[model samples]
Target chain A: MITLNIIGSGNVAQHLISVFQQTENVVLQQIFARKREAVSHLVADAEIVTNFNDLKPANVTIISVTDGAIAEVSNALPYENQLVVHTSGSMGFETLSNKNRKGVFYPLQTFSKAKAVNFKEIPICLETEKEEDFALLERLAQSISDKVFKIGAAQRQSLHVAAVFSCNFVNHLYQLGHEICEEHNVPFDILFPLIDETADKIKTLSPKEAQTGPAIRHDQKTIEKHLAFLDDENKKAIYRLLTQSIQKNNG
Target chain B: MITLNIIGSGNVAQHLISVFQQTENVVLQQIFARKREAVSHLVADAEIVTNFNDLKPANVTIISVTDGAIAEVSNALPYENQLVVHTSGSMGFETLSNKNRKGVFYPLQTFSKAKAVNFKEIPICLETEKEEDFALLERLAQSISDKVFKIGAAQRQSLHVAAVFSCNFVNHLYQLGHEICEEHNVPFDILFPLIDETADKIKTLSPKEAQTGPAIRHDQKTIEKHLAFLDDENKKAIYRLLTQSIQKNNG
Candidate 1:
């Protein structure tokens, strides 16, 4: 059985703790939080500890803390030459101190305290400093997820940036759309199917091929009408810029 | 049975024809194309007519052509005072000549020639100049879709603009993300789950409440890191602008 200890009481940490507890052939050794009470609800009180020095030795220790806290927390780990990893998409593997056999077990997904995500579908991006530690990381990742990629720091950083565009920026566009609907007193639910279909199209077709609208068709009249209709300067600027970008890319 | 004639053989017309043919109590009387062969395969040869003058009278004639062509085609319909509608989100009801009763039957979803969409889930936005025509239009719309909305010209136009933001512009962001992944030699499939989850979240949470990531958290370090990582000037500009927009919106 693969023994595991998780640090932090944030969304990622709590999610991992819940999944690992239910996973077969995996023993959740302990959970270490800055305050033991923070993670006490996630695990038995016996398995929750406040001090890093109280962390039990396990086959793998996942530091699922915030990006800024990852380095400081990793450096503070009392144990040495153990399989230690952090669940961060943007931070480099080197962020984990060399005092431990450094690795990464980043799950490429957004976690919410309210939403229950299926861990089996989430893609786990794995990296390891030592080749021997790679097998355990891969096995642990595969146990919880169907997809696992051996990604380095550079690729992970790029993936995270790309994610910012696809997830964060695209969501901002949804917010803009919602605002437009609200201004016009139209229900925002009307846009949900369209949003779902747009995302679904990218699965089968490249975003370039899936692109459609006045911009791609260069329907100047409609474009002008839409621009005249939008009152917000920020939205107008975004509309013009993205229209130009689409035309330029597809042109 | 409600008799219907469909004009134009583009993506929207083809999709409408497919759905209308399968709808109960709806008879697809004829399909008019500039070139009959363009839509002959969609329906029997007898139902496909190349000449606008040869179009038969029906309860309703749907001009499913491009935005610019809607007026021309609606004006050219041989029958007068018949219930004539165009399936365009952006076009106004007046686009149809006064010779016929005007209405709009816009399906508020993207239509692709290659992809077969489930028409039942698509929202059909309906508008009519004559209030009595509302029942027929709503009946036709409800026959093919579960969701139907009675929207006016201004509201429809606004909804179309909102759709451009939510669907078209969002797809462009996905394209940018795909490009970034290609540059990093990472398969774009890794971001699919995250993208789906982001879209799914807004269904329950408002886009503002659903927002997450560096920009929303005011993580300046990660934002700067991502901006520096992006090599394309256009992408970098979009990244910066959208980051600013998110902060401003959520702030």
Candidate 2:
């Protein structure tokens, strides 16, 4: 079994601990967090270390810290020549510079602390400075998920940008919709089937081919009518800009 | 079997025919289209009637024409006394004026002629003038779909607005991502898991609770960097507006 030491105690840390613990070929040896008390529950079976001196040696030291702290943490951490990794899609693998062997084990899925992550289903993106290290990281990822992509740091960054649009931005739009529904005193649940159907359509069709809207069709009349329904300038601006983009791009 | 006459051979009419045919107690008796050539393969069993005067008596007549022509078709149609139902969600049930038994069988889901609808799963938005007719329509709707909602035109307009944001607007945002990915030589399918995950998140958590990205965190550095990645000012404007909304709404 490969020994694992996870750093950071946010959603990614807790989720990584649970997944690693379940995998037959993996063992969670330690968990490091700035506040040891906050992450005690996460590292209950494993050793909990708050200081970089007691970072401990492991086959894999997975860092799941925030973007800004990645470089600082990597520079301070005392895992020399160990296989150091981070679960960040945007941050480069080279952030863990002290390690002779470095890589990424980024799961291309969002995590909420309370939500259970299906590690087997989530696609883990693997990247490393050395070929052997990359292969080792790939194997660890494949043990958990069938869909493991060997993506470069640049590609991962781009994919992360796309992810922001597809996941985060889309959720923001859902929030806007929920807001509109709340304002109108209409049940937000009414939109669930349609929302689900839209996602389902994209599986079989390209987003462009599956696209359905007054904006896509250039039905300015209906677009104007829908725009009239929005009281918020931000919502109106979104409607106008999206409508313009659909027209300009598709035309 | 309750015999039904479908007026108009447009998207809604064909979908309604397929749905009604699969239903236990409903049988399509006729298909009426303005042009003689409009009726095609699937409704071959149903007699095609071009002239409204040639329309035969049926338990129900579903006018699935465009919104602008709803009143025109309803007024010109010879079928009377039978439940006259129009399928436009935005149009009022009272538009089928001068007819004693008028109602609406507006399907909340967007329908395309090429797309086969699972009517059993789609929520049929039902409204009627008479109390007994509402029950009759509700029973008929329940026979084909478990999700039949009793919604007035105004409330449905609100739901339709919500649907625009959730389905149409969301799809447009996806199309933008696709365009950007294609331009950058990145496989757009890489964003599929993220898209599916975003939709799945809202199923379990509220959109506000599930919100992510630089905008929610007000990470202006990432937002500005993303904007710099795009060359188009219109897109930049959209990104700015949406980010502003995300920040404002979060507060």
Candidate 3:
């Protein structure tokens, strides 16, 4: 059995630990968190540690921490010979350099602590410096998921950038729509079907092929009318900018 | 088996035909289209009628024509006392006035012939002038989907407005992201996970709770940096608007 150790107790760590515990070959040897009280549930099952010195000897040490703390945590870890991995889409694998073996086990899915992750379905993105060691991470990933991808650091960075544009920014747009409905005494539930369908289409069609709206058709009349409906100055600004951007892409 | 007569051969009609066939009780009886070529598919399996006089006596008559022609098509229908319904989210049930029995069988979903709809999941909004007719319509809707709502014409209109903001507007944002990626020579495939995850989050988390980005953090520096990346006059305007909008919400 391959001994797996997880460091951190945030959303990613919790999700990762849950998946690791499920697998037959992969055993979660230990889990670490500074605030043990914060992760009381995790401490009960696994050999939980707050000190880096208390980390058990394991084949793999996966660090699931915030983006800013990645470098510091990589340096602070006691393990020198173990296969060290960080579950970050944005940060490079070299961020944990001088470590015997380093890699990335990024799951390209947005996770909330309260939400249970379906690791078997979510795509596991794997990357490593050494070609020979890639298979270990890849095999470990495939055990939990069928949608594992052998992505490089550069492609991963591009993925991160694209994610910000689509997930983070696109979500902000959903909030705007919700705000618009609330202001107009309209229930946001009306938009639920439309939003669900839009996402559903992308499974079969590309985002480019699935695109539709006034901006796509260059329907300036409707666009002008919609722009007039905006009461907030910033809302109007966003409406104008997005409208213009869509029109530019129309041709 | 309940006989279903469709009075249009547009996207909604085609989709309804495909779905109704899978359903246990409903049977697609006849399809009416203005053009013979348009009704070719319906003619293969079911009765096809071009003239209103050729309409068959069925349990239900669903008019799925363009919004502008809903009244005209309903007027031309040769039903004496059958359940007459138009599948429109915006148009009121009264559009089929003069007819003794009328209702709106508005499926709260965007229908494209290419996309297959899971009728059981999408909410079908129904409304009628007569209480009995409304109940019948609601029951019929329940046969197709559990997510049925007895929405008034005004509420339907409001829902359509929200749909525009959520579906149509959100799609425009996807295109904007695609354009930005294309301009940067980055493959748009990278954004798929993010887009999928963003939509999936709402299934569990509310838009307000699921929201995350530079805008929410009030990270003006990153927002300004991202804006600089998009040198287009209009793109800059959109960034500023969304940033301000998010900051306002967070505050």
Who wins the TM-score comparison? Answer: 1
Model 3 lDDT per residue over A52-145, tens place = 8888678888888876677788788776867888998766788784765899999877777766767777777899878888988988888888
Candidate 2 chain B TM?
A: 0.93
Candidate topping lDDT: 1
Better of 2 and 3 by DockQ: 2
DockQ of predicted model 3: 0.37
Candidate 2 residue spans exceeding 4 A from truth:
A98-100, B35-39
| Two-way lDDT contest, 1 vs 2, winner | 1
**DockQ rank order:** 1, 2, 3
Q: Name the best candidate (by DockQ).
A: 1
Compared with the true structure, the alpha-carbon lDDT of candidate 3 equals 0.74
TM-score of each: 0.96, 0.93, 0.78
Per-residue error (Å), model 1, residue B83? 0.5
lDDT of 3 at A206: 58
Q: Each prediction's DockQ?
A: 0.84, 0.64, 0.37
Clashing pairs in 3: none
Give residue B97's error in model 3 in angstroms: 6.9
Top-down TM-score ranking: 1, 2, 3
lDDT, candidate 2, A1-251, per-residue tens: 78888889887788887777777787888888889877776554788888888877888888888777777887777758888888877778766776447888888887877667677778788888888787768777887887898888777777777777777778888998898889888888878878877877776677777776566666666677778878888888887887787788778
Query: Which CAPRI quality tier does the interface of model 1 achieve?
Result: high
Which of the two candidates, 2 or 3, achieves a greater lDDT against the reference? 2
* Candidate 3 residue-wise lDDT at B174: 70
How far off is each candidate at the interface, as Cα RMSD in Å?
0.8, 1.6, 2.9
